[model samples]
Target chain A: MSLLEFLDYSGVAVFAATGALAASRKELDLIGFLFLAAVTGIGGGTLRDLILGQAPVFWVMRPTYVVVCVAMGVLVFFTAHLFESRYRLLVWLDAIGLSAYCVMGAAKGLAATASPTVAIVTGTMTAAFGGILRDILANEPSVLLRPEIYVTAALSGAALFTLSSEMGAPLWLASLAGAILAFGVRGGALAFGWTFPPYKARPGRHPDDVM
Target chain B: MSLLEFLDYSGVAVFAATGALAASRKELDLIGFLFLAAVTGIGGGTLRDLILGQAPVFWVMRPTYVVVCVAMGVLVFFTAHLFESRYRLLVWLDAIGLSAYCVMGAAKGLAATASPTVAIVTGTMTAAFGGILRDILANEPSVLLRPEIYVTAALSGAALFTLSSEMGAPLWLASLAGAILAFGVRGGALAFGWTFPPYKARPGRHPDDVM
Candidate 1:
């Protein structure tokens, strides 16, 4: 398989594993785990394809992505308890998937729409939206609402990759750089508890008056 | 405008209003209201079109739907306090949108795929998914997990429309019947507090052993 394709599949598997771990925390049945895994694995890509008008979305076209997700769900179901901290594992696995998916999504967006702005937006969305869906479904606090630098990391990777490709960098080099940068940012956040400042209401104005 | 087009726009407007009400409860700004309104209004049809392989999506092609949603957001932002019970209004408006959209979605599904089964499923999804997206984004409890007969109402309308149309009924008659049935079921639930039974675990099998 091509490097890009390999990264795409790996991202799917890792994201699916994180989703299954969430189901384990919820104490859901096997079907719930499989459902969450599939949705979390493919949700972002599906939204990207819909927005970009890519018919018969990637999972519908290949089916192997879903197979990988289900396999991960089943595997995680039996072995989740073996991990000392499932939440920690979930975070790290999600970081890997986010790093891989951001670059892959950017590449697909560039190829499909040939618009750098769209590429960057789609790339960030592709990396983050699956987790958003997973959290919503599992009734967990969304990563988007957390003060962490999760989406910022994805956005940085996408922007960097898009800029590098536009500057005539080799595809492989751009992809590797983007992935590493994303992972590094996320790792920093996890290890050091890095966070963005929360939004603050103006001192004198009413909350409803901001609009 | 044709009847179907009228219903479709009404559905968008009503659903958008519901979304704006959700934002109001959260004390969000104007931008948040607009974002939630737009997503809740168009999310379901977008999903249906994507699954049916309709390119460019409905809102992307027409743009009027989004305009309507923005208008609703602005209106609701200024006037939400007028209502004594915003939640009650939101539920009623949602029911109206659900009834109209279920029939319209089924018609589109039937026209696009010419398969009754796909029509039924797509119709139910189209009616229900927008609300699901709205709840998730607003951090509210999803209607899907509730015992209330929300999805079943949508499903009944979709199934009724598909069945009637397939039986050589006139388009207008089938659409009206289907919509009324959906509204009736939802109204009954609202007025009488009707709900479906929750799933029961087996006497001895553990939750994890269900698989």
Candidate 2:
């Protein structure tokens, strides 16, 4: 597989794992855990595709991602008791997925000829929006509105990627650099318990996050 | 306002009311009702915005729609218990909103110079999609996924609008014709208990819906 494709799979796997972990927190059974994981992992991309006027969505078009997520979900279900820590592993995986998906989305946006600003927004949004949707569907507050720096981290990485492209950086270099930056920002948030202030909080949590 | 805008607002009002009623079924508070109402009312439009690459979203841009939905939600919260028959009210309002939004979406797609097939799809999607998202959030099976004529009705209206537009019908007439068709189809389903047959029932109920 190409590097980009490989990274995409990695991102999906990590995100799915984190989703399963979250589902386990809800005391969900194996299938429930897998179901949530797949839904959370794919929710953002589905929204992105629908909005971009792309037909069938990525996961819908390529059902293999579905298979992978379900498989991962099944494994996590049977062995959920193994990872009973307070989200440390899941947090790390989430960071990796966030960075990886950010790079992939930003690269894809630029390839689609989006303007620099739009590209960054599209990329970062693609990276973080699905988790936000999943949280809302699961009746949890979105990480986006929590001042938790999730979107900010994605944004910073997206900006760096775009800037690197403008500076004539190669795809590999740009992606690697941007992913690191995203990981750093999000990692910092996880390690230090960083969050934005509450001025931007939506009423009773996110309104459009459900959509 | 022109008749078109009048129709649009009316559709929004009806859809919003239906959303509030749905929330009432769960015994959610006023704010929750508003959240659900606003989403069900404008969710399709928001989806359309993303597809059209319209930024910040309509409710975000206008803000009034949010106010309207919130106000309607408050109204429903107080009056919901007073209604002896909520089922009929929600269903009919849903029908009206679905019809109006379907035609409106088609018109927007046409105005954007989108391809005819795309326009038809966009129109129908714009009308019904928000409800689909709402159902997911509400932990219910999407009406679209069922053997219901919901999406099919939207498709029918969208096709009508596309054909009328191609034949050079005036915008008002075309939209009216299309919307009436959609309303008729949906109304027929509600009256006659229409449903889509299951595609093999999928072994067992996917336990995810239980949550």
DockQ of each: 0.11, 0.05
Q: Which stretches of candidate 2 lie over 4 Å from their true place?
A: A1-106, A109-211, B196-198, B201-211
Off by over 4 Å in 1: A1-43, A55-128, A137-139, A144-211, B145-148, B194-211
Docking class of 2: incorrect
lDDT of 2 at B84: 78
TM-score of 1: 0.61
Candidate 2, residues B1-211, lDDT tens digits: the string is: 7756766777677788888888887778777898899988888888776665565777788888888888888888888888778877877788888898888788777676546755775686678776666676567645543344576677788889889989999888888899899999988988896654322212333323211
Candidate 1 chain A, which ten residues in sequence have the lowest lDDT sum?
Answer: A202-211
